[model samples]
Target: MLFIKRFLDQVDEKPHLSAVADQLREITYEQLCSRARRAARVIAKISSEVMIGVAVNKSADYVVSVLAVHLLGRTVVPLDSHCPISRLKQMITSVDLSLCLVSRCQEDKLTDMLQASIRLIYIEDAIGEEDANDNAESTRSVEEEAPAYVVFTSGTTGKPKPVLMPYRALNTLIDGMAKATEPRGTTLLYASQGFDVSFQEIYATLCYGDRLLIVTDAQKKDLYALTEQLSKERVTRLFLPTSMLIPFVTFSLYEGVTLFDLSEVIVAGEQLKVTPIVRRWFKSHSRCRLINHYGPSETHVVMTCQLDNEPDDWPDLPPIGQLIAGSDAWLLDERLQPVATGCSGQLYISGRSLALGYYGMPELTSKSFITHPLTQERMYNTGDICVLNERAQYEYKGRHDRQYKVRGYRVELREVEVAVLASGLVDDCLVVASQLGLTTSLILYFTAPERGQDFSLSLHSHLAATLPEYMLPSFYRGIADIPLNQNGKIDTAKLPQVGGVRPRLSSNYVEPQGQLETLVCELAAECFGLDRIGANDNFMEAGANSFTLISMLAELRHVLGHSFRQTDLFEFPTPRLLCGNVQRSKEAPESKNSIASDTKRKLRSAAIHNTHGRMRGRHA
Candidate 1:
């Protein structure tokens, strides 16, 4: 392959350049290539396509082992050392692994997981410091389509899919990235090695001759420390899933923290919901370019991007932009025909990035990577249903199977469910799309907020105001917690069956006397999906927290000619108290125009001038 040889040539040219830095060790380019070549020599003796499983911690040795596999003209299966022992066994069995390369520390654990028949070689013992016996003599180099590695992704079905990639596809991606970004002096933050996105970070950094810095496992869980480290190191490039980014902003982790002249940051893997705090952070650190990246494991690292122009781009649905250099996107309807632009369709991708299909599962591979009607090219069908907007940007519309038609109205259960969780009243939640014979319904499972206050009434009331009656959940159950599947996603199978459960309002409370107070409480109850509003319950913690909702409340207060401060409503959303406060108002109700004008000015000014450092953290 072009890369294996090119990597060696680069090392020869710049031997002293830093290649990998992890925890307390740093490996130079020369050492990397030398070790890789030595390891490759050992790998060449092995039979099969040279697919070897690697089990190493976040260390320089782990990086060398990956490169070594490449040098041997064989694919490398990089396994997470920290994954469940059972998962490791399953992967080894599926890949028919010839050998495993692991550090001395993981030798015992590897032996426990691997079968007696399989070989587990220690890295320190297997690849010694001696120079590799050269392979440039008689052996002919293979072509580009040679397998590089097989990445296993958590499957929706029971088993995980081992997605295979060729050297050409990966090399093509590397070339495209070299063309898109700036220079090789970039320093990257390596978060997780198991995830494909981390691979993207690894290759992108090396190809550009940039420094690759690995974040420790402990640092990964601690956002405050991670952000501090990122700032301290002056890291220029980073790749993080949206789920991780949200909580970082929510907790004000960036407060008072000065960014390390960050040049570029790429966020992907999950839907990005950039909040107000994130927007302010980006504005203050305007030099950094926030890129919204999208793609599945099969399509290499990224397929599309919606570049961030402002910080506000974070909290909304970031558009999955146009296809990359060698890739083509076909948005097809149910009949497999190209749908009209702006119409929702199943997205299919073709070209180099399409994986060599799932490992061993030929049937599944054939089903997903099918031939295109007109082009005659094989394209991988992405189950995600998406709509191409007027800008030709792809706006994701939930999964095709996730859409449930309830009472003649097609509903996106995720949107409604996310709205509920956004209220902050629910600690955790899951929205399940299920069909009982002819009837379609949404089953919601949630855990109440930490204060032990039941939010059943308020959430339903708030949802009613924003959602159509038919779109609402037929059943909402509060559980101590929603169960997780083996792969860590919400497990729909484990959700309790709601067969005979009757619909019931969570709370029934009296209204306050003053008209202003009564209306606000009613509005709160409606917007929050609750049956009744309570005086003592904190509105912010109820998950009804957001700038948009605050804006809406201000609009309503102006329309009713009520003297309601946004924070006052936030502080006292309960009926009786708000009504009393409104009734005893000595100041006249400000004009609707004046109120709206002032609120807009204040929010914009606050956002632009929000220099206060507040430490906050949120889970994605």
Candidate 2:
């Protein structure tokens, strides 16, 4: 609330400009301030306690509607455009929403749903309805302990649990994030709107007089054009999931031809396992900076870790890293005892970044956020397992609630399962960390198309690039189909168990030849913990990436007595293509100069032309 008046006061100075539908639409500072105030005035006339859903994509109207609700002193729930109508209906009913701010594009799709119980209005209409006299004259004391936004998470109870985040908590997060990333006039891309991180992006950009680029739901799914826009827009900041980052790297946008002059790139949502080639490509592009960010939604946006080292130098699985500016963390044992450095335990996060609690679910909130028995400070039990390293940084081990011990090592079934999914071997996969009595074992369940090629061999090949030997699954099982729970999560309990035998594919493609291929194959076999390697295997679809590929390249280069950059492998991912590229690079040149001779020739040509033009002008 402290930011409200200040944010409005500065609105006329710093406006938000967006490029949409191939046209540059500028939202001036004064316009935004005026719109928010107007929208707020309109909303204030409505019921204050009633929940409202703002269903709009990346637009000025969406921003204004959000601010309007804030001004009206009401909680605004963000519902993404991508969510299904059924889900939206359920959310509306559950939250007891009295009104919905529907975007113009969404008007046709959702017009029928508007009824007597819930009023619906287009964002543009609401903005237009604001009176000229309406201003921030009616200032009130800010609510110190009230919910600002309620972000929902997928729940096992077949419904989403809305996590209520208060203004004070968000202010704490904003302060911490601001201290860590001092973006002065920076432009940050808003990737996830429904997610709490969107708020961070919004506040961060507005607070620092920076620009917030809202990527349309369409643009996010379109990688090729998105890359083009990123370069053209001169966008400097970006934060998204690892899944999204992989394509950005694999496509080689970092090499050149991007719209934006990206200075900082932060990836989160899931674990970051960037390939060596990706890292090397980023390093070469001196203008762009890459960071691995780790956090949970419950902590506002981020609580810990800003990965600042080489992805390869990091652990087999990189450490998640240290606590953030206004947050603290600890690894605790089963009995709530603090674990020593390098010892794994459940992760607990504390400090001002904590949220208010789950909306209308006080018991569940109490269970997760509890008093630190000794310090008596409120701490959030993250339900994640981690280890505090010697550097006092945290290494993500697994989920405490989801994983269990198997032969002394705590096995994260989902980690293995995600690796499997990333391998592109199976359509749906789930690794259950269950036991048959005292003996512990993992059951890998997957489903693929009946006619589609088997991925077992490819899975082994891809896992070699990222996972360690000990973390490998004890058994592989193929189900006719993977059962999905009502909440859309994989139903591991329903997976039928099978014998401990690797399924064989019917493929008959011959393996590629040459010593480099042989060496690559050998390294793949070792990294994957596989007995054999095949030629027809794809690098990424099989889950191989810049990180693991780098490891393979490191070993291969050492044996070959020459260094190969990460770009070479990514350009030529498979053994056959990789060997060809490697051979070509080796035969072409070993020069490590920053600029090529041809580039110098072009620069000299331009300089001579400029000199001649200047001389001609003086004579005239």
Candidate 2 lDDT for residue 540: 43
- Residue 481 shift from truth in candidate 2, angstroms: 12
Per-prediction tally of clashes: 34, 15
Q: Best by lDDT, which number?
A: 1
Question: Model 1 Cα displacement at 597 (Å)?
Answer: 39
Tens digits of per-residue lDDT for model 1 on 1-620? 26555566566677798887777877788776666666666666664456888787767777778887776667888887655565566677778886877777775765666636467666776568654353233123656787888887644343456888888778777777763545555455555555666667767777666778777766655444666677776678777655445444433332346665577777775555556656776777788777777777778644567455566645466676767788888899878899986788999988888889888989989988999999999898877788887776777776765544443233456666766776777887777756421134566778885545666667777666545444456456778778887888777777776533223333344444544444555445433434444543334333243322333344344334443553665555545555556555634465342335667657644542332111111100
Span of 10 residues, lowest total lDDT, candidate 1: 611-620
What are the TM-scores, per candidate, against the unseen true structure?
A: 0.66, 0.66
Model 2 poorest 10 in a row by lDDT: 498-507
Please report, in order, the local distance difference test score of every candidate based on alpha carbons.
0.63, 0.60
- How high is the lDDT of residue 452 in model 2? 55
